[model samples]
Each structure stands twice: as structure tokens, then as C-alpha cells.
Target: MSRAFTFPGQGSQAVGMGRELAEAFAPAREVFQEIDDALEQKLSKLMWEGPQEDLTLTENAQPAIMAVSLAVVRTLEAQGGFKLADKAAFVAGHSLGEYSALAAAGSFTIADTARLLKKRGQAMQRAVPVGQGAMAVLLGLEFDAASEIAKEAAQGEVCEAANDNGGGQVVISGAKAAVERAIEIAKTKGAKRSMLLPVSAPFHCALMKPAAEEMAEALSQVDLKAPAIPLVANVTASRVADPATIRDLLVRQVTGMVRWRESVLYMEAQGVTSYLEIGAGKALAGMIKRIADKEAAIASVGTPADVETILKTL
Candidate 1:
């Protein structure tokens, strides 16, 4: 059966995410070590033994999550004998997880991806001053309805839908006042619920234009190659493998809504019935189940034990 490998982005991070994998496998440990060397810091140390506040910072969380995801990929290749180029029909990730997907598909080296993410995190955080921007989840509303609500609530401010995460969940981002207005308008428009997200900045909105510009310059210096397998890009909600296109889309993704639900649907339409989440959490797997229904096969590969368990599938 054709399968797709997906990675989760921020908000899936937790203390001690890949600690077990590192302890149980030499390859996994090597992955962390390489990332540490690339970033010239012991990010794994912070991830394993977090102050919580620092680890949760966007700059730190982005690369840390990619490190775990790449470690999972290394384990699957070394121990599980599942070559990503051979098994997965497509690869995708949410937001920063897109870096992980690119790394897995061979568009970027693991070390390079780590460094890029660190820069990405910092760029995103510094794009808008804290409290000037905000994001919120509006549940029980279709994207069309949510878009209308966001536009209506904007009132000439910068409010826009950020993530369409499927299952009636849509995240909106922009100026704090506009986000607050959108929340109110969403509730009045019959949204199931609306609450401000505890995010440092309003990502994937017009306010992130500065961040997108930052990424464009940063990405230009990075070595990008065509992925061994196709990558379902976040911005376009379509599969793209060309290196130039990948680089361009990555910059655009900073201000583009994460069409996760649509990406999964696109993959499903392409005959990918099985989805493997190769990362710290089972979040993408859960989202796939919700988006694709019970018939879709889902798996999570976070540790060496999970690698061994998934060997039979290959």
C-alpha cells in the first residue's frame, strides 16, 4: 500500500519527547549530537530537561522538534530498513514541521534544517512585538465561513485565517485587537467556540510579512536540493519536489495558512491510505484519522522500539 510520512509542528513539543529514543538507540543519539554540533548548542539538553519557558520559546521549539523527527527517520532507515525514498508516496508537515519533511525527503541535510529552524523560530518570534499580535482557534466553522468572519471582523485591521486544521478547527491570526474582534464575531456567527491561543506572535497572517522576508533571505543561503520523494507543501496544499519551488514555497509559508486538512485530502486522493507520523507526537496521525476517517491506517514512529514495531510494515 502507498503510504505518506507526515511530521507535526509546534504545539506538539513536550519535555522529554525523544529522550527514550536517544537512550535506546545509537543512531538516535547520533541525530541529537549532530544537531547540537550544527547549532553549536546542547538543544537536546534543553529539550530533555526543560525550564519549560525556554524550551517552549518558538526559536528553540522549532529545531528541537525537527531533531526528534529526523532521529525517527534515521532509526527507521537504519534499524527498521524502511527507506523513505522507497516507502512513502509523499511527505508533509505543519509549519516548521515542513523543514522536517524536507529533511526526511533529502531536500536538506539534517544539520542544515536544524540551523534553518533555529533562525526561523527567532524570525517568527521577532516579527511582531508580544501583545501586538495574537491567534485564536475558531471551531465548528468551515473555512469559507471562518474567512468571512475574519474579514468582517478585520474592520481594516490585519485579521486572517491562519490554519485550516480540519475537523471544523480553523485558526485565525493577526493584530491582537483584530483577533479579539474576530473571536467575538466568530462566536456571534455561530462558531462552536473561540479562544485566544497562547502564542507569542500572530503567525501566518499579514503581520508575518516581515518574517516571510526574513526567511526569503535566510533560505537563499541554505543549500536546497530536490527531495527524493515529493513533498506536499503547506502553502500550496499540493505536492512539489523541485528545489527552487520548495525554497520559494517555504518563504511564502510564513504568511500562508497551513492547509493541513487539504494536504491530507490531496494525499488521500493520490491513493495514500496509510499515514506514518515520524516525530515526537502522534498529533499528525490523529489529525489524519479525523480528516480521512477510520479507514485510513495510521502509525507513529518516535522511538527505536517503534522502529522495530514498524519493521513488519515495510
Candidate 2:
């Protein structure tokens, strides 16, 4: 089957995610070491033995998830197993996981990605004061309906759709009052459930303009090369590879809706029948099923056992 490699974003992280893979492969261990050297922090320790709140911090979670994803990529390429360039038609990532997809496709060095994500996390957190911004999930509503709720709730504030996750799940982000208003608006419009998300910032809304500016400067400093395969950008929901275009989109993504549903649909139209989620959790896999054909195959690769099992099938 034609396949794509995908990466998970925040909220997929958990303690002990990459520990087994690190133990199973020297290459996997090296991925963590490279990130540690780049950041000069014991992030792996935090990931392996987390005090959940600390590990869940944006600064830590961003790079930490990318590290585990790269570790899995390294392990799969070992023992003459599946080659990402040969086996995948495209690669995609959700939110911060986009960095992981680029690293997997050779767009950025592991160390550089790690450093960038750390800065990205810090910048995103600094963009708005805590509790001033918020995100909410409006279940049982299509993206268009959720977007309308965001617009109506803005009240001259900054509410906007952040992630159109499909499966009747769309996330809204913006000013706290605006987000709270969106919840009421969603309920009034007959949403099955409307609840606030526990995210630190209102990601992917006009309010994130400041964070987008920070990413613009950070991305300019980094050297991004063409990927081994085309990447379906989260913002555009289509394939892109030109380094300049990719850089521009990365900045836009900070303030653009993650068009996840359209992204999966685009991949399926491009003949990607299998989506391999290359990191911490099954979130992306579930979304793909919701967005595309339910029969579309899906898998995850983080531990040694996953690597071995997938290799056998490949």
C-alpha cells in the first residue's frame, strides 16, 4: 500500500515514551543525546521520569516529542529496515510535530530542530499572559460551524478556529473572554459538548501574531533544506517542499488553523493509504480514520517492539 509518515503533536507526550526505544537501539539513544547536547538540558530525563506538570510545560513538551519521533525514525532505518525516503509518499505532522516531520525528511538537523522548538515553545508561551488566552473544544460541530461560533464570540477580541481536527472536533483559540463566549455560542448552536482546553496559550489565532513574529526571526536563522519527500503543511493542507515556502508557512502556522481534516484528505487523494504515526500516541491515527476512509491503515512506532513488528510487515 502507498504510505505516509506522520508525527503527533503536543498532548501525545507521556512519561517513558522513548525509554524502550533508546534502550533497544544505539542510534535511538544517539538521537536523545544529540538533543540533550543541543539544548544543554536533561530533557530526556524529564521525559522518561516526568513530574507530569514539568514535562507538560510547553518549552519541554515541544522538543521532547520531536526527540522521541526522531528516535523512532532512526531505529526504523537501522538493521536494513524500511527507509523513509523509499517507503513513504509524504510526511506530515500536527502542530509542533511539523518540526518532527521535517527532521524525519532531512529538512533540518536534529540539533537545530531541538533548539528551534525550545525557542518556539518559549516564544509561544511569552506571547500572551497566562489566563488571558484560552482554547476550547467544540464537539459535534463541523469546522465551518465551529468557525462561525469563533467569529460570533470574538466581540472585537480574537477568537478563531485553531485546529479543524475532523471527527466533529474543532478547537477554538483566542482571548479568554472570547473563548468563553465561543463555548456559550457553540452550546446555543447545538454542540454536543463545549469545554475549555487546558492549553497555556491561544494557539493559531490572531492573538498569536506576536508568537508568529518570534518564529519568523527564529526560522530565518535556521538552515532548512528540501525534504526527502514532500510534506503536507498543516496550514495549507497540501504538499510543499520549497525551503522558502516551508519557512514562510512555518511562521504562518503559528497563527493559522491546523487544517488537519483537509490535510488527511489531501494525502488520501494522493494515494497514501497507510499513515504511520511516528511518535508518542495514537491521536493522529484516530484523526486520519475520521478524516479519510475508515479502512485506511494506520500504525505507530516508538518502542523496539513496534519497530520490529512494522519492519517485518514492510
Candidate 3:
């Protein structure tokens, strides 16, 4: 079966993530060390021994998650003999995890990905003032329906769909007041449940134009190469490999909805029967299984144990 590798985004982070992998494998430890050196800070330390609040910050969480995903990839390379160029058909990721996918596919080095994500996270957090923006999940609703609710609830404020995360789940983000109104409206419109998410910013909306501009400048200076495997971009839900196109898409993604459900469906249409989630949490894998149907195989590889099992499968 053809396989696609995917990565998780922000909410997947947890304290003590990647620590087990680091403790179990020397290669994995080196991944974290390199990321720490690249950013000139103890990111791994913060992730493993988090005062929770600090690790949960957008800046710290972004790079930390990328580090963990890279560490998992490194462990697979070293111990499982799983070469990325040989195993995967394409790579995709949820929101911030897009950087991890690009790094894995050779669009950028791990260190560069780490640094870029640090800047990206900081920029996104600073785009809107604290308490002025918010995000919420509307469960048991179609994406178009949820988006329509957001548009109606906007009432001239900025409310838009942020993530179409399948499994009847869609996330909306924008001004706090508009999101609050959306939650109430979604419930009234036959949504199973709607709850406000405790995020620092209203990500992936027009309000994030400032962050998009910042990323355009940052990405312009960074070294980016075409990936060995095609990338399923978040903004478009389509495969892209040209370096120039990838850079432009990354910029737009800051102010665009993460078309996650459509991304999986696109891969399925292209004959991808297996999806491996190579990151800290099993969130993406779980979502893929729910969205892509039981006929597709899903794997979560984050630790040495997972690598060992995958070695046997290979």
C-alpha cells in the first residue's frame, strides 16, 4: 500500500513529550540538542520539564513540536532503517506541523525549520492582542455549514473558519466576541456541541495578515529547496513541490484555513492507503483514521518502541 507521512500541530503538545525517545535513543537526543543550539535556548528542557504555561506558549510550543517530530524521524532513520525518501509517497501536516513535514521531506534542514517555526509562532502570537481574539470547535457539523455559521455570526467582526478537521469537527477563529457568538449560533444551528478553545491568538484568519507578512519576509531570507516528496499544503489541500510555490503557500497559510479534511481526502483520491503520523501526539493519526475510513491504515511513530514495531513491519 502507498503511505503518506503526516505531523500534528499545536494542541498535540504535552509536557514530557519526546523525553522518552531522547532517553531511549542517542540519535533522537541529538535532534533535540541540535534544535536547542539552533535556537540558542533550552527548548527540549522546557518541553520535557515544562512549567506547562511556558511550554504552552506559542513560540516554545511550535519549535518544541517540530523538534519532537524530527527526533522521531531521526530515530526511525537510525534504528528502523526507514529512509524517508524511500518509504513515503507524500508528506502533510496539521497547521504548524506543516513545517515538520517540509523539514522531513528535505525542503529545509531541521535547524532551519526550528528557527522558522520559532519566528512564526512569535509572530502569530503577537498578531492580535491577548483576549481580543479566540478559536472554537464546532462538533458534528459540516465544514460549509460551520463556515456559514461563522460568516453569519461575524456581524462585521472577523470570524472565519480556521481548521476543517473532519470527523464532523470544524474550528473557527477570529475576534473573541465573534467566536463567542459563533459558539452560541452553532449550537442553535444543530451542532452537537461548540466550545471555545483556550488559544492565545485567532490563528488562520484574516486577522493573522500581520503574521502572514512577517512570515513572507522571514521565509524570503531562509533557504528552501524542493522536497523529495510532494507536500500537501494546508491552504490549498493540494500537492505542491516547487520551492517558490511552497514559500508562497507557507505565507498564505498564516491567514488561511487549514484544509485538513480535504487534504486527507485528496491523498485518498490519489491512492494513499496508509498514513503515518510522525510526531509527539497521536492526534493527527486519530483524526486521519476517523476521516479517512477504516480501509486506510494509520500508524503513530513517536518513540523508540514505535520504531521497533515499524522495523518489523518494514
Candidate 1 matches the true fold with a TM-score of 0.98
RMSD of 2: 0.9
lDDT of prediction 3: 0.93
Query: What's the lDDT for all of these models?
Result: 0.91, 0.92, 0.93
Candidate 1 lDDT over 10-108, as tens digits, reads 987889988999998888899999999999999999999997888889999999999999998998888866578988899999999999999999999
Please give each candidate's TM-score: 0.98, 0.98, 0.99
User: What lDDT is reached at residue 283 by model 1?
Assistant: 77
Ranking by lDDT: 3, 2, 1
Q: Give a tens-digit lDDT track for model 3, residues 39-136.
A: 99999999999889999999999999999999988888887665797888889999999999999999999999999999999999989999999999
The parts of candidate 2 lying over 4 Å away from their true place are none
Task: Indicate whether candidate 1 or candidate 3 has the larger lDDT.
Answer: 3
Clashing pairs in 3: none
The TM-score that candidate 2 achieves is 0.98
Q: Number of clashing pairs, model 1?
A: 0
